[model samples]
Each structure stands twice: as structure tokens, then as C-alpha cells.
Target: MACMQLLLLLCLLVSLCNCYRMFGRFSRIPPEPQSDSAVQDQWFEQKLDHFRGADTRVWKQRFYVNDSFTHSDGPVFLMIGGEGSANPAWMTHGTWITFAEKMGALCLLLEHRFYGKSHPTKDLSVDNLRYLSSRQALADLAHFQTVMTEKLGLGKRKWIVFGGSYPGCLAAWYRLKFPHLAHAAVASSAPVQAKLNFSEYLDVVQSSLARNDSDCPNKFKVASATLIQLLNFVENYEKITSDFRLCQPLEINTKMDRAFFLDTIAEYIMDVVQYNNDNREFEGVKTTNITIQVVCGIMANESWGSPYDRYVEVIRTILKATGEKCIEASYKKYVEEMRSSCWEGPAASGGRQWMYQTCTEFGYFQSSDSSSQPFSGFPLSYHVQQCTDIYGNEFNLAMITGAIQQTVENYGGLNIESSRIVFPNGLIDPWHALGINTSLGTDIVAIPMQDAAHCADMYPARPEEPFVLPAVRKLVYELLTKWLQL
Candidate 1:
């Protein structure tokens, strides 16, 4: 009876699996049609849907063409999103999308693979995830170009790719990889080099604290000290423990916990930076409460309690825009791995393994860019060497730097001049955008946005109007137009 019951359960599970596979195969949204007659019609706005690749994975795509279309006017504008996002929510709802609609040109938003409704594979490992690389992403845009020209029968219509941040990097790469495909490309806040160095970002935080002088120094100091202490505890676990027993949860004062404190400082800084750079005392007293809420929310949630949590959150926001859910399960699994392996062995016996395993919980630390030699041009390796030399192997600075550098380099390189790529950065960015001082004969366009944090664009309330707004937009737009023409 027991054997029969098990066989029935197995059969049911197989049936359910088969049903899911079949459902996924037919779930894709179909591309809209473009009327050939409308190609010459300037007042015809239409959306298109079609399958481009041979693979059965027929991912859905949307094309918003203006009311008027003429092959004589040349290439249509294609918007690419940054980082793990499919499309910018702001663009879809804000002035950008409206501008595209008014321009009377085809505005194509291509969702990146593995994001939104475009899951390209069943497995999401580091190996299979290689498809998520910049090269493959560029290929997606190229495929769209072919579709627009050949399948859609839109004769001689050029494409102009535009994006900011990650998409900005993509725009530059698209121009480089497929020069003939696009007539023009515009990238904003483009990050072209790969590597992560937090020292400069740390310095930014310190400077901000000094400038504010708003009791935030205490919080910053506490957080920094806690991080160092945590590193020390992990490094000396074997020395302190006899048989590698799990230690009791370290009781931390909620008000003083480093993570909470850091979040508070970051929130205040971002609030100030995002709004018009008003150093005026924040009117709301809830800033501290909000910071505590953010910190506690991340820590209490099993999925968000890791060092790379910030990056993961950002990635999630981007992916969510495209209707993708890739990280939730992975995050849970990571937490389980850490919980199960804590203090399982001596520092020398299993410390490295434990650290690597737990570190993987943070998605931002994973990068494919590395060199066998110590001093290669790779910024990730350089930062890793610096960290390991100072703090030792207990904390894998290599992993952190490797992840940061790869993402930046893969998505951020902008070749403005024949001999140089300028990387303009605000002083207060935590991403350490200033850490990369030089790369591949590229000129660094490092602009220090006074009292700015993260991306300079985040500071909308800069005192200087002409220097901030028009300058940024014109520089990015002109660079893309010129690069595409070249």
C-alpha cells in the first residue's frame, strides 16, 4: 500500500511539472503589427509585437511609434534601461516617454533577458547567467535592429539607442559593437570600467558627515566601528571558540547598530541630495525613524539581511519594472546557507568556505572580470589587493571589488574622445565612482557635484541651474549624437 501511494505521488508531481512547462511555452505576449503604408504617414502612431529569435522563448516587446513616420527622417529611438531594469518607470510615466510620443518617431523599449517577462532559461546559475553579460545584452538590441529593418519592412529606418546609467553604458557599447545599426546613441551617467573600491565612497560619507555636523558623525562612527568589529569577530572565530560552536546572537542596541546608523546617515544624505541641495535642517523629525525602519526592515527580513543587500534591492527594483522575480528564492537560500554553516568549523579549517558561501548571499559581489596577475588593469583586482593586504582573507574584499568593477566596467565605459573616456562623478556617491582614476587611454571626466550624493542627477536642487541641468543633458545628448554619427 505504501509503495503504491508513493508511485501515485510521483506521477502527480510529474504531471504538474509537465503542465508548468507547457504553460510557460505559450505565456509570451505577441508583438504588434506595423502597417507599411503608415511608414510614410507622419501622423500614424502604432505599437508592434513580433518574435525575433529562433528560440521557442518568444519574449514580448513593445514599440511606440509616433503618429508620423518617414523613412526619409532616418532611425527610430530605442531606449535601454540601466542595471537590472527592463524599462525606467520614470520614463514610462514622466516627461521622457511623453517626449518620445511627441517626437513622432518610433520609440522602442527592449526589455533585457532574464528581466520582466523575459526569462531566457530555467537555471539561474553563475554559468547560465553568463547570458546576462553586456555582450549578450548588446546582441538583443542588434536583433531588434534587424527585426525593424528586415521583418517589419521598414526600409532604411535608422535606430538611435538612448539610456542613462547601465543603459547609458549599453548605448555606448551598442554604438561600438554595431556602428551601422544605429544612427545615433545617447548615454547619461555612463559607467564603462569594471571594479569596486569603497574607500573613496567612504571618504565621501566622511565628508558629508563633516559638512552636516548634524549628530550624524556619531552614527557614522558607530557603524564603521561595528563593521570592523564584525570583521574581527569573523576572523577570530576559531581563536575564540574551542569546538566551533555557534555563538549567541550579539545583542546590539537598535539605536547604535552600525547598519542602522549607516542607513540613517545615507537616508539623510540622499534626502538632502535628491532635493534641491538644501542643507536646511530636515523639517521632518521622522528621518531617524525612517532610517530605523529601513534598517530594521532589511535586517528582519530573511531576504534582505546581507552586506550586498543594497545592490540586491536596487537590482530588484530594476527587474521588477520589467515584471521579473529572480532573486527572492536565491536570497532565502543564501540566508539558510549562512545560518546552517555559522561556526561549523575552525577558522583555518573552514573559515574561507563559510565566508564565500555567505558572501554569495549578496549578489553584487559576483563578477567574472579578474586577472591571474595581481596588478592587471582590472580595478576589481586592485581594490581586492588593497583590502586583503590591510584586513586579510577573512573578509573577501576581492569578491566585493570584483562584483563592483565588473558591473561598472561592463556597463559604464563611454568613449567620448578617440584617446579617452571621461567619467564624471559627484563627490558623495557611495558607489565609489571616483575610485577609477584611469582606464584604456580614456580621459576621466570627474566632476565633483558640490554637496551631491550618489549620481549627480540625484541632486535636483543644485544651486547652479545652468551648470547642473542643461549642461548634463546637453553633454550626454551631444556625445551620443556625435558618437553615432562617427
Candidate 2:
């Protein structure tokens, strides 16, 4: 009887321990340290600083969690915004932060380094910028996942990574890099390719132009010819002199230089390609005629001013702080390197490190790199391609091309097992989604909005508003949810 009683007690103890372990793994996060279980109205926003390096290279982060949030049943969704955008902005946006909070999930935002308040360096050179690459950004996500899990002490909690555009690329890359860390990832309008091809972009633009007027085939043909002429003019001028002269054309009233024209064209191309055409009445819509006029105006000038003056100013400020000359001779040298045929350093045996150096060197001066070779076959005549603006300074077309190409090649692949990629285009937008062609197979779905221009999400009546395509959202949500199941 004594032996039997001892055996029973041991069995009971084992079962109790197992139950405790299981409970610990699957339990909800406990209440805040300072709050009682009854406190329903309290909210918490915690600021955190972490060092990825030893020499005080710290990254600033913030977390917003509402104590009053009653729904703890879903996964924790983390949102990362695109390049040049900060975390706070997205946190307040309708699609991101608002969505997470309403869905009853823990919402987290990560601001990339060297952008916004997450400056990780006193010297933000191309070399140091390596940490800001897609790889490093994904690593940052993985690290945060570990930290969140440990801090919350919830073993069964699921994690979802969500982003669009550039951040969407990060989201997809994160899922691939740290498959075990995140349960699922949602990438919308993400360009997975590291490089930019003007040819692919031209095709999209031509298609959009044709959609505007099927009978206006000649207009697109003319546009294509003009674009090529401009590209050749710029390339030739850059090959000859460090400085050129600009002459005002009869068409445009704006006083501009070569840099201005090139930058403007690049920006215009990017905009038209991603235009949201479904709702033409949106306040942000610009007519195709205006876009064409703007392009022509820039190219007509001998040397226009620099495009993206603000970006140049930022670079100047950084350079000034380091007691370096605002315009270094090396800056021009790097620009020349971008235009050279041997730009990527003999492509056959090159690795990502070479690409990193090329990116960083170019990033310093707001100049272009030699990464655009892949899309060199792109016909520039489709858009107004100009060499020198009104001010006589030449724009680095080769470098810009290279960078786009590099971006496409590096991050362009998709995971067939997990999710499907989609490129939604607008019919009137010159820079249509068709510009990028990925090697990730035909799993990508392209949906062209008839009248939209750049950023279809902001269309007057988005599909998400009235839930016009709840099925699409359902598909995305289900895929992410399944991926996140821990």
C-alpha cells in the first residue's frame, strides 16, 4: 500500500509539472508592472534604445501598447515603412497602425537606421551604410522578435511582419531570412528586384499611354523617341565635361539645370509607373500632358539645376559636419565610375560586398552608381531622356540605372511555398508596375487599374474601404495568419 501511494504521488507531480509548462507557453501577457488587473483605461508607450555595435552606435525604438486593449487573442503585427518614411507617420496612418490596433493585436514599428531618429553613425558613409541593407534590416526584425518574445514571456504568441513598397521588400526578405522567427509576412507592392530597368519601365509607360487612347499610338511612339534622345544627350554630355550649359526651351517656364532635369525625370518615371488609375478624381492626380510637358521642359534646358535639392542639402549638411568639403573631387570620380562600362568591377566573380561599397560611395554625395547595366538595353526614347540641364551639370544616367538594377537583382526573388506577389498598375501612370520582371516564377499577379496614377492604395474609393474585394484581403489575412501560427 505504501509503495502504491508513493507511485501515485509521483505520477500526480509529473502531470502537474507538465500542465504548468503548457500553461506558461500559451498564456497571455501579464498586466503592466504598475497597473492592477482592474485598471482598464491605462495605456503605455515605452521608448527603448539598443546598441548593435560597441562604440555607442545605438538605435532608438518605441513601442505603443494599450492596456485597455481587451483582445489579446490575435498575433502581434509589426509594420515597417518604406525608405525615407519614419515610423511615427505609419503608426498614425489608416492602413497600418490603425489597422493593427483595431484588429486587437500588439502593434510594433521599426524605424530603419540612418533614417528618422534611428541614426546609427556619426559618419554615415557607404561602408557604414551596409548595416542598413535588406539583410541587416531583416536581422533587426529577427532580433526584435526574440526580444519581444522574451520580454512578454509568451511562448505561443505569433508574429506577423507587414509592409508595402520598399518595406514590403524587407518584409518578404525577413520571412525568407528568419523563417523560424516570424509566423508570416505580408508584402504589398514590394519590388523584390535590386535593379531598375528603364526598358521594362518604358514598356509599362507605353502600355499606360496606349490605354489612355488606343488611337494615340503615335503619341507613345513619340514619347519613347523623346525619352531615348534625352538619355543619349545626357550620357554624351557626361562623357565630355564635368560642367555643361543649359538653354531654356520654348515649352517650359521653370529655370532648371541638368541635375534638376535628370532627377525630375527619374521621379516622374517612378511616379507614373506606380500610379493608381482606378479613381482619377483623387486630389493628387496629374494629367499625362502635364507629365510630358515637365519632362520636355527639363530636357530642353542646357544645364538645369539639381533634382531633389532637399536630398542634396541633407548630404551637404552631413558632409559639413564631418569638416569635409561639400563637393569632394572623389564625388565626381565616383560619378564617372558609375558611367563606366566596368562599373560593377568585372561582374563574373563579384559579391554583395562590392555592391555595398558601390551603393555607399554613391549614397554619400546623392549621386548614382554603376548598377544599372542589366537594364541598359532599355530604350530611353520612350521617355524624355536629357543629358545636361540648363545649368550645364550632367546627370549620371548609368549610375541611376545601375542602382535600380542592383536593387531588383538582390531582392527580386519570391518564395513559392508561402505567398503570392502582386503588382497593381494604373493605366495612365507612365511608370507602370510592369517595369520590373522577377525571376521568382509567374506566381506574381498583376492587376491594372484603368484610370489610377501612382500609389493605388490612395485611390478615391479604395477596394478596402467598402471591402469591395474582401476575398483578396481574406486571402492575404489567412496566408499571414497561417504563417504566424506558432
Best by TM-score: 2
Q: lDDT (CA) for every model shown?
A: 0.38, 0.39
Instruction: Assess the local accuracy of residue 12 in candidate 1 as a C-alpha lDDT between 0 and 100.
Output: 37
TM-score of 2: 0.52
Give model 1's TM-score versus the native structure. Answer: 0.49
Q: Candidate 1, residues 1-486: lDDT per residue as tens digits?
A: 543454344343232211111111101111111234432211111112113344444444433344233334544777774333232333233223443444445555665554433445443333334445556667777876786667557676657676544555667667766767766554444445442332233334444444534434344344334444543445543422211111222223322232322232233323332222322112211121222224323323446444334323433333343232221211112222222211221111122221332232212221113221101112334324323332346446556545554544444433333221233344444333422323444222344344443334422223543255446544544443444354
lDDT tens readout by residue for model 2, 303-408: 5333322223322333333233222122122222222222111110111122333242211111222232111221332111222220113224555455555554
**Which regions of candidate 2 are displaced past 4 Å?**
1-57, 61-70, 96-102, 152-155, 196-198, 215-217, 220-266, 277-471, 481-486
The clash count of every prediction, one per candidate, is: 29, 74
In model 1, the runs with Cα more than 4 Å from the true position are 1-75, 83-104, 152-154, 196-198, 208-219, 222-334, 337-427, 432-467, 474-486
* Deviation from native of the Cα of residue 50 in model 1, angstroms: 19
